[model samples]
Target: MHDATVIGNRLRTLRKWRGLTLVELAGMAGMSKTHLSDIERGLKALDRRSYVASLSTALRVSEADLVGGPHLTQDPVQAGPHSTVPQMRIALQTNTLTEPATDRAREVGILTAEVKQLEDVFARCDYVTLGSRLPGIIDELHFHAARPQNEAAQRDSLTALVEACMYATFRMKDLGYGDLAHQAATRAEEAARLLGDPVALGKAAYCRIQTMPREAGWDRKLTAARRAADTLQPHVRSAEGTAVLGMLILTSALAAAVAYRLDDARDGLAEARDLANYIDDDPCRNWSAFSITNVGAWGVALAVESGESGGAVLEKARIVDESLLLGRPSRRATFLADVGRGLAREQKTAKGALGWMLRAEGVAPQRIRNSPQVREAVAVMIQRSKVAASGRELRGLAARMGIPH
Candidate 1:
């Protein structure tokens, strides 16, 4: 049987349970009565994530129910590498110190190059390769930090450890492992403190801000971000400091947007844009992609997330060259997902939204698969595929993702 028919049946059943007529549900969902009738008759399907979200909201049901299964209920932490934290902690605690002093300078140079390599891999969005490499790098740095022969060597090892842990924190956060990400950030903060590097502390703080609980509220998160950025602003002569401060401000804007504080979001974005003006784009500082163009891209995402929709939001996004976004795979993927969502909010079909989301998935499968938004987008796509022929590709993709047919 066509899966769309099954989805349509479920939706119809839900509406009946609520004692709502087709016209009533359609009115609440802000769709045409005829279109809603077609869906109830299994002649059409829910084709957009926004549509599914809207209908579910109107019906007082979960989106998962409309889609006919609990595809989204899986615990990401249990299903992924969250359990690796204890092992990583053990590696840090048990590593042996570096030996002797003859090749300390050469070894430092090698470790620096390795850190660069790791950053490059991260920029490319090669999470699998990064995951495999992190343990060894963490152990090596810890080993060196434990047994450096002199002060200079100790600083080198400590710095390398901070870099590695920061990368670990970034990857863990991307994968949606909040607790593990927070642990990595904590380790990075400790190392940064021992090194007495203010710039490094700013970076660690940036990672910590993401792992903060939503229960803590946006005011608390924004305050923390403001304090970190303000502290780094005076040290703005250094490129690293400038980048960290700009990013912190940008992050504050994101937090404010999520909390519905549009005024605060605007203020933070303006400050970040001003800071971005004074800083040059440094490729080696991959995290510093907080350029003016990047700020515009983020502005588009923030607008979409705020439930504002019109030609203006998508138009603003269009002016940002796709090439600029491609330089950072994570940013590129997120920007594309936001664009897809904005398109959907504009009443585009599920296929249109899926096109944008699939483009992001093609570049970074882990990113898309791990995203709740993409999962719901895919759920809508699958529901729309009721006729069988039109949804074949999406069905194949869903099968690969272990979404039940």
Candidate 2:
């Protein structure tokens, strides 16, 4: 039997439950009846964020309902990373800016070093370690920031808290704890505002945009990214400022592309490329990963979202310096998974898409397993696979993602 949790199954069930026909849902979502039908039948991949956002809006449900998020699995490797979410949530909820939940904390310098180490862990996509360590770090940082011994110590503690909270935001989001992720983002923004640092505030803005409700708010997300980018443009004389500004522009480009604004997306990409030319690829710099190669990686995603042909998308992916992506497993895996997603759109290239996805999984198993886009692409490819070898390969991937094949 086909899995009831697959996006197609969920979509069909939701539509019927709402007493809507395919034509009605499609009309509401700004798509054709035939397209909606294909999606319901699993012939078409429901991989586009824009499509999910539209359908969720039309159905008056959250995007997570359609995507079946907070996906629990028995496999330890896949399920282990999510184990710490409850603890992290408690820490975030119980703590405050003026009064932290913890009473004692290490020195500011030690906490700062630990935060840096956790940032490295994040870059490697080591979510298990990242999640396990975050709650303690968060509480400690909060204690230090809230109970500062001196003005300099207070500034240092607040700065470390912002970075720690940002890391927590990323971890929560990746593990599908959207509400917790938003709380983490809010904490980060609060710390940045207290510090009165423009770059820190820009980083916090990026975190907020990432955690914004995916069901709607495309315009709000895009506007926020553009406004943050504009505010940071004057600070680009330093590498850190340039990288953060580039990151914001890339965020704008992605928000535009997902909103189906091709012209705006291209303009954003063009502007990002110009900024990227001024800096080197430094994954640690503001954690932006903004560089010429990263811009190319973003281009592949934009092309895929724009409904460009598979060959065209592959052409865009070809120019990105894959070597530059190695240090940041999250960025590297995302780039590879997006390439697979784009190629899986066409039957002619679907067979080859599996290889790229496998590479992505090898780079970051948790990320690939949790990604709705990657999961839907795998489902579509499984439905299309005829050869026994490819079928076996695709089924293995599906099983890893807890999707029955």
Best candidate, lDDT-wise? 2
lDDT of 2 by residue, 370-398 (tens): 77788888887777788787888899998
In angstroms, how far off is 164's CA in candidate 2?
1.1
* RMSD of model 1 against the true structure: 7.4
State the C-alpha lDDT per candidate: 0.68, 0.85
Which residue pairs collide, candidate 1? none
Please, what are the lDDT tens digits per residue for candidate 1 over residues 1-405?
113324667888999999999989999988899978866654454544456667888888766567643222243422233344455545444443443212223366577678878877777667666776676677766656666668897788788878888778877776555566778888778778888888888988998887775445566888899999888777766666777888899888877876678899999888887877777643335355777777877888778756555465677678666787676777778778777656554443445665777787776666666564555445555655544554676775565455555
Clashes of 1: 0
Q: Give the CA lDDT, 0 to 100, for residue 282 in model 2.
A: 58
Candidate 2 global TM-score: 0.96
- lDDT assessment of candidate 1: 0.68
Model 2 stretches with alpha carbons more than 4 Å out: 1-4, 284-286
Prediction RMSDs, each to the true structure: 7.4, 1.9
Runs in model 1 lying further than 4 Å from the true structure: 1-106, 281-286, 309-312, 384-390
TM-score of every model versus the real structure: 0.74, 0.96
Q: List the residue pairs that clash in candidate 2.
A: none
